[model samples]
Structure formats: C-alpha cells, structure tokens
Target: MKRSIALLALLLWLSTVALVHAQTLPSVKPEQVGLSSERLGRLVSMLRNDSEKGQIPGAILLVARQGKIALFESVGVLDPKSKAPMTKDAIFRIYSMSKPITSVAIMTLVEDGKIALGDPVAKYIPQVAEMQVGVEKPGADGKPTLELVAPRRPMSLQDLLRHTSGLTYGIFGNTLVKKQYLDAKLFVGDPTNAEFVDRLVKLPLASQPGTMWDYSHSTDVLGRIVEIVTNKSLYEFEKERILDPLGMKDTAFDVTDKAKQARIAEPFPNDVTIGTDTTFFDPRVPQRWQSGGGGMVGTVMDYARFCQMLLNGGTLDGKRILGPKTVAYMTADHLDGSVAPGPLYLPGVGFGFGLGFAVRREAGVANVQGSTGEFNWGGAGGTFFWVDPKEDLFVVYAMQSPKQRVYYRPVLKNMIYSAVVKPNGK
Candidate 1:
C-alpha cells in the first residue's frame, strides 16, 4: 500500500509539472505520430553513447511532429568539470541562430507597415550613406590594397535580412577591410547597441550591396535598427514580441537567476575558441551589445517553440506574431541569382539563403535527409533547429561542443528522418 501511494504521488507531481510548461508540445506516443518508438530509441542510444565516449558534452534533443512531442531527452554533463547531469532546459550560446529570431522581429515590423524592405538603410542609419565598398586593385605598387568606391546602389533593408549587405564578418575574410572590423572594435566589450553600430557603420563594405552573400554584422545592425524604430532595445522587442508570446521562459540574452546559471551547458575546457561563443564571454551577466546575428542563449524546448511557430505559419496557440504570407515570404529562396555556388555557409548542396534561414532547394543534395521546402539554421555553439513543413515536423538540438557541431547536425537529421514511419502527413 505504501509503494502504491508513493507511485501515485510521483505520477501526480509529473502531471503538475507537465501543466506548468505552457508551450510544451503535447505528449504523444511515437506510434500515434506515425513514428516507430523502437527506431526513435536508436537515436537516443546514439546520443548517450556519444556523450559517454566524450565525443561531445551535454546536449538536448526535441523532436515534435504534427504538434506532438515524440522525443525529448538530455544527455551528458552540464560541464565536464562540475559533472552535473545535463537537463533539457540547459542554456546554450545559440550564435548565428539569433539571426532567425532577429529576422522574425524585422518581419513583425514589416507586417505592421512600419518598415519597407526596399527602403535604403541609409535613410535610418544615415552614416551608411557615407559608407563605401572596399575595392581591391593593384594600386601604385603591386601589393593588393583596398580602394574605396561608391556602391552601385545604396543597400536596402532587404539586403540586410538576406545577408546580401556586403558586410563581412572580420573572422571570415583575410582582406584589409576584414581587418578593419577588428581595428574598429565593431564588437562591444562593454558598449550599447548604438555605440556598437557607430563602429559598424563606419567600416567599408566588402562588396556592393546585393552583389554578395557575406554572413556578417548585418543582423547585428538590424538589432540596432529595431531599437531605433520600436524605441525598445532588441532584447526588449524580442522578448515582448517573440519570446514571451511563444512562452520561451528560459531564452534570453542574460540568464538572471543564479539557479538558471547553474544549468548552462559548457563544452570541454580545452575546446578551441569559437569567436564570441567562447566561454571567455559569460552569458550570466547582462551584455551591452545584443547581437541579432548571434549571442542569444536558449534551451531545446524554447527554440522548439520558435521553430514550431514558423512551421505553423507564424502563430502558435492563438498568438499571431506574423502573418502566414510574411512567414512564407521570409522562408522562400532569396538567393536566386545573387549568390553562386562557391564556398558558402549553408549545411548542404541543395540549400540557399532566405531572409534568415537556409531554405532547402532540392531533396537529394543535402548532407542530411529532409524535404525540399524545409528551412533551418544553426549556432556556433552547436545548437540547431529545422522546420520541415512538408512533413509537419520540427526538431531542436542544443549543445555546447563546438567540435562536434559539424558532426551532430547531420547525425540528428539523418536519424530523425529515418525514424519517421509516416511522411507528408500520410
């Protein structure tokens, strides 16, 4: 009788916790969702095996299909040093994954008819009118030096959203202009978004606007723009408009609570430097520069809501953050002729740039398995999420091991697709 009483109490407590997750995906058996429970276990075992082998640190994976969660699990330690068990709510750097959130914020303004995609960015950030394209030519001597030239046309808000603004991340290129980002201190050590943009606006663009797809400070600039237009900080606008509406409780630029800080997933101490995602810059304290391109931290479930919102055509559970048409427009390929097949940042062959995602262009060319209409993005901190509208599926993977980031994204993709017993809502 005592054992039965204890078991009943435990079950009741679990139900209460489930009710607390306002945005939790409904729990459903894999078979009910047309997924093989046994096959899904294969993916879980691999995750455990990888963590046990020290191939990666802590990770959280969530797989939801048809609005029901089929898998959600955490594996490994929160930190190798602490050895505390990982949890589903662990915070992670999220890096470039910030782009999608920032992009969605931009769309919200667009839907309100507050910003026009074609408007010259210089109109708002006037210093941009003074910005010039960095041209390299054999000038005076043969040493390949930078020459300033006027852009064919001023960069517009559209250019910023699709990463065609010609703004280069200093770490990616070796040119003199790339070095300028370093010399200019475009990234803040302790500066406001306005102060950070002061340096960004002064740097010469790497190419003429709309002529190049350089993953860069463009979204960071957009964050500043959000502040200027909404009279709210990017952090504020994102929370009120995106995070809070989506019920992403633990996602933020700063993890204010000391207890939440304890849940931060960290890579091995000896992990190679990952630019701003380096453990050197802590997320516990509030940051002066809120990077829209990267820097936000979140959990697997928090991001799962964001991805599910996109999959559900811009609304979830009565909160309409964006119109279905706007969401569709943003996820469509914007790279048609703007970018060619050279070295690019996409995860696979059949992917192309959208407003804030890598939209899959073909079915068989991707490094992983997915439908052509799927869109996705990843963070330098080994976090990733993808929305497969065709399959009515979305998955989120959060981790902190930069070394295994490259390996696990495809691994999760392959495993998730293989475990699906039904496709295209059949």
Candidate 2:
C-alpha cells in the first residue's frame, strides 16, 4: 500500500510539472478565434507543398487570434542536409527582428528616465557627434566625388529607433558612403559591440540625420548604448529584463547550448545568399557582437510570446513589459513628409516606419493585404511577424531561405489575411 501511494504521488507531481511547462499561449480551434479552419489548412498545405518541392528547407508558422493560438504548424525538415523533421520548437535566426526587441529595451530605459528619445545619440557615445554626412558632388572632370558635410542637427535616439539616422547598409548599395562601409570590413574580426561602434562612427553618414529613411547600423549602435547605460552586455540586459520575464527561454544572441543546437533551422545549401554577395551568418557559432539590428535566434513559440506582448499593448500574462500608451506611441508613424525614402525604400508604399516596425498607414495603398494599424518587421533569414491591433491577431513565420524572403513575405501576408474569415471581432 505504501509503494502504490508513493508511485501515485510521483506520477501526480510529473503531470503537474508537465502542465506548468505547457502553459504558454493557450491553443484553441480556428473557429473559436474567428479564423477559418479550412483557410488555415490551405495555408499549411501550401507551405508543406513548397517544402516538399525543395523550394525551401523547412518552415514553422504560428497564427494566433483573439489572444489564442488558432494554428501552429511545422513543415519539412529542420535541415536539408540532416533530414531531421521540423518540430514546433525549432529555432530560427530572426536577424533584423532583433531590432524590435532592442527598440523595446531602449524604451524600457526611456520609461525608467535613464534615457530620452530626443536625447542626442552623441550624449551616450561621444564619437557620434563628430560624424559627418557624405554627399556626392560633380568633380571638375564631371565624375562624381564625395564631399563630407556636417549634419544640420545631431542624431537623436528616436532617429535610431525609426531608422532615420542617415546610416546605410554597405551590402545593399554601392554608393561612395556605402563603399566606405564595405572597405572598413566592420564584421571582419568579430568585434565587440564597442569596437563595432567605434569603427562605425568613423564612417561618413549616408544622409543628414532625420532627413532620410535608410536601413543601417543604427540598431547595432543602440545595442552599444544599452551596454553603456546598463553596465551590462546587450544580451545580459535583454535576457534579464525582457526574455526571462516573458518566458522566452529559447531566444538569444546564439544557440550556445549543445542540446538546443540541433533545434536550429537551416536553409537549403544552395539558397544561402542574402544579398548579391552577402551570406547569412551561422547561428550555432557564438559571437561577442550582439547585433541589435540583426543577430538573434529564437523558436516560433518564443517569438509568438513577444508578438503577443505587442498585440496585448505591451504586456503578456500579467507581466507588463511596457505601458499601453508607450506601445501605441511606438507603433505610430514617426516619419513625416520631409523625410526622404532613400534608394532602398524598405517600408514600401502606404507604410511608415514606427519605432522598430513598418506600420501600415492605409488599408489599400500597400500591395499586400493587412489592416491599417498593423505593425511588422522581418528578418534577413526569412522570418517575418506582424501584429494587427484592429483584428486582434498576430502571425509569426519562420524559415531559413534568405533569397526567398522578399517573395514569400508578401505571399504569406496575403494568405494570412485571407485566413481571417471574420474580421473586426465579428
């Protein structure tokens, strides 16, 4: 009788632990969340078909509505080379998606009165004050020449958050300033955040701060600021304040643990190039540069919690990450008519950049289907997510095909909005 009682108690304890482990976002039927089950099935089938055709190595997509998961599906293998089946908890290199998290980190400092958005970036990193803009001018021989000019105004923290800080990604363009960035070889030796910023500040700005929307190393600089202000590494501060409290156990700068390394998703060997010449980094290898712009890996469910927090007005499961008003402020459009959309106009038509997201400004101007208030951003490694406040919905799509990201992002967006059979809480 004593042995049986002990066995029962052990089993009960195990079951209780399992329940606690499973207590992420609750799962519910598609109908319960006002999504069409058939439509969601079609979306999954399309992804599966794409995988089977070898168009992609694998993918994991999560769609949640009304604060409940309506669909969570994994298709294809975790790695094309290993042929390991993809699992729901498979990790992905979320690249630029790291920006939003870093942006949130900066906002947390703002909330605590440690930083202000209007504060000049030079206030944190003094070298930034010496930075100058590069303008192309016609030389005596009629060839284009580079001229360095002082910025009209200093770059503010808000400028970094909205990507209007006159920074440019070298890989994206071949202008004089961009060429300087490439010549610097910023990522050559796996420089630490401080070293990276020190090298970056020496480069000429692509445009005057607050005058252009150019996607660049602004977030990476923000990561250095986090380190400076908090007296902790970017990952350390983020993990403690944001990831730990939000139950984002699998999100980090890299997959350092031997156990979780197998779960890291990979792209098809042939489809690895991001731009014309650049390739995606290996997430399995740990690095000191915790790139705030593009260096974080996470599972779909882990990101789902992050998105849920955004959709829930910056709180999840009673843990308030940021106040509702702050979330709204972050999501609202920061660009005005004066800010020029540079050569790489990433936000596209009908969208304006918010703090760290491309917020839809209208219902019809954008080529893709989405609500006006929806804010979103994506990774270079084919991971994308969006939060539609109007529909009370959010979707996270994870994959590893960098070359196919542009094509698939819109296709996935159109398909997801199509799955919403009922809208506006109907």
Candidate 3:
C-alpha cells in the first residue's frame, strides 16, 4: 500500500508539472484570426508535397495572430531513417535563434540596471580590451597580408547586440582573420564559455568596433558577459529569469531526458553542411559551453510562447519578462546609413539590426512581404520565426534542413503574407 501511494504521488506531481508547462494561447480557426482557411490549406499542401517528394524530412509550423494560434501543423517524418512520424512536440536544434534568447537575457539585466548598453564590453570581460582589429593591406611581395591595428574605439555592449563588434564567424568567410579562427579550432573540445572567450580575445577583430555589421560570435561574447555578471551559467540565469516564467520547459542548451530524446528531429543525412565544411552540433552530446549564439534545442510550441511573449510586449500569462518600452526599444532599428553592412549581412535589404532581431525598416523595399516593424531571425539549423507587431501576428517554422533554410524562409514569408486576406482582422 505504501509503494502504491508513492507511485501515485509521483504521477500527480508529473501531471501538475505538465499543467504548468501547458500552452496558454487559445486555438482558433484560421478565418477567426483573419487567415484564409483555403489559403492555409495551400500552404499545408506545399509542405506535404515537399515531404512526399523527399525534398524535406518534415517540419512543424505555428502561426499565431491576435494572441491566438490559427494554424499549428506538423508534416513529414521526425527522422528520415527511423521514419518516425513528425509530431508537434518534436525538438529541433534552434542554432542562431538562440541569439534572440541570449539577447533578451542581457536586456533583462539592462532593465534591472545591472548593465548599460553603452558600457564597454571590457567592463565585464576585461580581455576584450586587448583585442586588435585585423586589416588587410599590401605586403612587400604585393600580396595582401593581415595587419593588426588598434580599434578606433572599444566595443560597447550595444555593438555586440547589433553585430557591430567586428567579430566574424570563421566558417562563413575566407579572410585572413577568419583563417586564424579556423586554425584555432574553437569548438574542437567544447570549451567552457570562459575558455571560449579567452581563445576568442586572442584573435584579431574583423573590423574596428561599431564600423560594420557582421554576422558573428558577438552574441557568444555577450553570453560570457552574462555569465560574469550574474555569476551563473548562461542557461541558469536564462532559466530562472526568462524560460521558467514563460514556461519554456522544453527549450534548453541540450536534451538529456530519455523519454524526450525520442522527439528530437533529424534532417536528411546528406543535408547537414551549414557553411564551408561546418556541420550542426549534435544536441544529444553534453557540452560545457552553452553557446548563446548557436547552441539550443527546443520545440515549436516552446518557441511560440517565447515569440508570443515578445509580441505581447515582454509579458505572457501575467508574467512580465521585459517592460513594454524596453520591447519597443529592442524591436526598433538601431542601424543607420553610417554603419556599413558587411559582405555576409544576414539582415538583408530594407532591414536593420535591433537588439536581437532583424527589424524591418520598409514594407516594400525587400522582395519578401512583411510589415515595416516586423522583426525576425533564423537559425543555421533551419528554424525561423518572426513577430510582426503591425499585423498582430507571429509565426514559428521549425525544421532541420540547413541547406534549404535560405530558400524556404522567403517562400514561407511570402506565402504567409499572401494568406492574410483580412489584413490584421480588418
């Protein structure tokens, strides 16, 4: 009788935990949210046709408008090899989508007066003060050589948030500085966040601070700073402050639970290369570094809550993660004409970098269809999300196809906007 009572207690506890993590958003028909059911069917057919053709293994998409989920869909298999049917709860490696989460954590510190945007990054991580900029100049043999020069100014916390800290991801470019990053083998052993930053400061910056907007490891540096400020692991601080309150129970740097392991999504075996000779990390393997830039795995529902929180001005289910004005400040464009975009500008045209998102500056300038205030970012692993304040809409597309991400992002954006027949419910 005692053993039965203990088992019953455990089951009750698990049920209560599930209730805590349950989605708070209401579900409605697409039409109720000003979305055309017929048009949405077309979107479903496209994904299903692609899955049937083996173009994609599978995917889960959640479209929410006016604080209600209009379309929550799953198509294709979770694992192409195992042929496990794709489910709404399937976990995906969110990659650089992790940046927005890390960025939000830093902003929470900002809200608490723990850190200032204009403060020099070296204030928190002193090693950054010693880093130099790498400039390519002609050598005696007339061949271009890297020249390390002092930065015109120190990199501020804002610079890191905006990707203007002059840091470059080694896998994307072929510059001398990037070659040095490759030579360093930064991820070979999965160093702790501190060790990662230590090796990074030893390398030269790609440009002078705040001069260029480059997709980079700037968020990773911000992650280390977060660790330093809170005296907690990046995951720990984020969990306590953001994830737990938002009930993002499934989003984490890694997945270790045996039961949840079965839900991990996988891409096609041949579709893994992200950049020049680089592949996505396996989230199953435990690592010390919680790469704030590109090392998180989560489900579509978990991310929807996060997006909803941002859309609702940093509050969800009565829990305020950030102030409304802070959300406005974060979503507004930070870039102007002066800051030149780097060659690998991930924000594309008609958009600018905000704190953690690519804020759209115009509705018609870019080939894609989105509102002027829409802010978004995608992951190297193929997950994508955007929150359009103008449309009262947010969408989360979760997939694992690295090579096909760029193509599908625009396609999905165009199709989603096309289906908005009522235009913010008229």
Q: Each prediction's Cα RMSD? A: 4.5, 2.2, 3.1
TM-score of each: 0.93, 0.96, 0.95
Counting clashing residue pairs in each candidate, in order, gives 0, 0, 0
388: Cα error in model 3, Å:
0.5
**How are the candidates ranked when ordered by TM-score, highest leading?**
2, 3, 1
For model 2, the stretches where C-alpha displacement exceeds 4 angstroms are 1-23
C-alpha displacement of 97 in model 3, angstroms? 0.4
Q: Which tens-of-lDDT digit does each residue in 1-426 have in candidate 3? A: 999999999999999976765555689998998998888888888998999899999999889999999999999999999999999999999999999999999999999999999999999988889999999999999989998899999999999999999888889889999899888888878899999999999999999888899889999999998999999999999999999998888999998887889999999999988888788677788899999999999989989999999999999988899999999999999998889998988899889999999999988889899999999999988999999999999999988999889999999998988889897857
Indicate the TM-score of model 3. Answer: 0.95
lDDT by residue for model 1 over 1-426, one digit each (tens)? 999999999999997886576667788888888888898898889989989998887788899999889889898888899899998778888888899999999989998889999989987899999999998888677788898999999999999998888787876547788888766766547778899888888889988898877778899889988999999989999999999989888888877789889988888887747753334357888888888888788888888888888989999878888999999999998986756433456545778878999899989877679998899999877888999998899988888877778888888898889888876567
